[model samples]
Target: MPEYITLTIDGARIRVIEGTSVLDAALDHGICIPHLCHMRGVPDIGVCRLCLVEVVENGRSKITTSCTLGAKEGMVIRAHTEKILKLRRNVAELLVAEAPNSRAIQDIAVRCGVTEVRYPFHHANCVLCGRCVRVCSEVWQSKVLGFVGRGKDRHVALPFNERPEYCKRCWSCIDVCPMTITPCDGPMKEGEEYLCGKCASQLTMIENSPDSCVWCRLGEGFQCSRWRP
Candidate 1:
């Protein structure tokens, strides 16, 4: 077992294992922290920034991402302070303008009480949470999807904006995406040489290699035949 550390969240004292994120601690203690693009089994990209919390240390409050930041002893975390709430509302508004068609974005905006967007809508319809990129790189281990352009054009896609021939027809990228920018087209028919089910064209390169089962890898220190059976 790992060492557990005590921390204060919104003035509530709690103990959690070391390396545990503040968001995880909050969830464990029945504290609600608003977030998006954060799945339990996925990597913490922290691109949404909706889980920002105010941490008071040495008599000062600062905003930080709870998903990426681990809890430490004597740290005071304020999850739903006025300042943090206002920031969250503003961030929600920005996301709404970008993805006006997304119900998830609209629902989050409503929850944050953001009725209108004050900032100029310069960003595209994408929130750029990088969930697609993270799923492709971390979970699938395929370097296919990436940020092609810079600044406002910094959207996730294949290299050189051209599809690769090494794709393996895995839809992991589409399955784990937070934003619904990528549509789910049906699988290819029998006549097609390589059939792409869902967004398999976007993340098929990962299946090029034979990977072992994740559970067996951690359970017995090697690939277990039980998973195959």
Candidate 2:
């Protein structure tokens, strides 16, 4: 028999299999926790920091990424508190500022209640979500892709900056990349980046019910687990 653990999320008691991450458990029960850099069946690195949740203990709370947080018996978690929403909104804003062209990032920003971006746009090409590198190494076991360099120079690249002949050419890396899906209006020009709030209306459902899954179209091609059939 499989062992199970019960945890409290947003005042609701949830029972889940032992060792399941809090993010997965909440998502399984239709609780929304926005995230990127997490792929089903792959080990979570918690790089995106989007699935953050507060764990209550000793009359206080500690914030951590739910994707890396294991479910334990009697655990108390708060996924949508005002503090969390504010921080998550800021994180989503930074993501959009970093890559305003990604429809996925734009949708996530709207879902996080970002009406404006406070930071200057870097307009960088990648957000370093590591989806491609993880998918290649963990899913395909190819290990052909990796992040090299350091600081701002860091980025994903083929080993030795060259594609080896043994490469499968599966292109699974590209399929899972968030950058592949540009904004509906196409690429933004230099110094012309702006938050795509066209889907802002969808946030109405989230506002009314913070914890319920509205099945917002935001996750369509972003492969958000909540959007899965």
Candidate 3:
């Protein structure tokens, strides 16, 4: 016999299979919870802490990670409360501050209503979400890349911190890594089009340089980087 459980997310009642996480349940209902480290058909570690939600029990509300919290019978969930929004904003701001070069983080900051960061920007390259590490070890089964150090020194590194001879040459790690994306806010007129992150940053390299279609990261993905016809 199959088991199902009924739960309420933001006042919308839904029934889902037992053991389904609240994040998946909400997503199944077209409710998007802000998240960074979630990938479908892959294991969720709940390390991003972006999909935080409130679960109400006995008239008391508590914050929990939705990707790990399973939906149970009569569970009441609030995905976007004021407190949750504030927390999410803070998280988004911090992420943006660390990797302001990532268009993904910038867009997420906008979505989370984060305009500025209070903390000092570290200008780091990797947010250390471990998406690439897990993908390589789990889906690709290559284990070519793994964490190199502990705490602040920790980072994704190739086996022995050097390229392996048995490497499959598949760039799946780059494709799965969120930091690899350099999205451009686009569809600009004439010269403004095709201003990808790499292309846009070129302005700092050379003064009074005209913007052109560098066909950067977004273009490589075949994403929209051209003007509307």
Candidate 4:
């Protein structure tokens, strides 16, 4: 039998299994928390800051990633506060600016209400979400791909930039990468990268009910946890 703990999320009280992350608990109960770098069966590293939430302790609130914050008895979590929304929007904007070519990132930016990116676009291929590296190592157990380098030079790569002979060749890495799907306007040129807000039409229902799940396809491009059976 699984042990359960009760917690309050955005004024709603719910009981979830012990050891479940707050992000999972909310998503399972139909509360939407924008997140990347999180897979249902994989351990969450909170690489993407989009799932930021407020943890009310005493009289003050501390922001943290819900995917890494476990649910506990009597815990209070605020996922859609004005502060969190603004912070999430900023993070989403940065992600889109970093990799405007990804349809998944573009959709997420729209969901986060990113009208424009203030930062200069790097047009990098990866956002360091670790979805590919984590899924390759954790889920597939192949350990074929990993992060190498440090700081701005960090990136995912096969060992020595060569595919290993023992690799499972599952292609899970490619399937999980956000960059696999080009933007609705198609891939942009180096100096012509732009944020794709084509899916902004889907935001009406989401804006009306920020916390409720509308089954938005914003996450479909990257296989959001909500779409997992």
lDDT of 3 by residue, 12-120 (tens): 8999998888887877676657677766556788887888999999999999889888889999999878899899889888887676656666655655666566766
Stretches of candidate 4 off by over 4 Å are: none
Q: lDDT for each of the candidates? A: 0.62, 0.88, 0.69, 0.89
* Cα lDDT of model 2 by residue, 19-108, tens digit: 899998998898989888777778999988898999999899999999999999999999999999998998999999999988899888
Q: Write the per-residue lDDT of candidate 1 for residues 167-197, one digit (tens) a residue.
A: 4458776655545432123222233212112
Error of 3 at 132 (Å): 0.5
lDDT of 4 by residue, 1-229 (tens): 9999999999999899987999999999989999888888799999889999999999899999999999999999999999999999999999988988898999899888889989998879999999988888898788988989999999999999999997898888999988999987789998898877877668888878888878898856687788889
Candidate 2 wrong stretches, greater than 4 Å: none
How accurate locally is residue 174 in candidate 1, as Cα lDDT from 0 to 100?
68
Candidate 4: residue pairs that collide: none
The model with the greatest lDDT is: 4
The regions of model 1 sitting more than 4 angstroms off are 120-123, 165-168, 181-229
Better of 1 and 2 by TM-score: 2
lDDT of 2: 0.88
TM-score for all models, in order of appearance:
0.71, 0.96, 0.77, 0.97
Candidate 3 C-alpha error for residue 182, in Å: 2.2
Pitting candidate 3 against candidate 4, the one with the higher TM-score is: 4
| Candidates 2 and 3 compared by TM-score, better number | 2
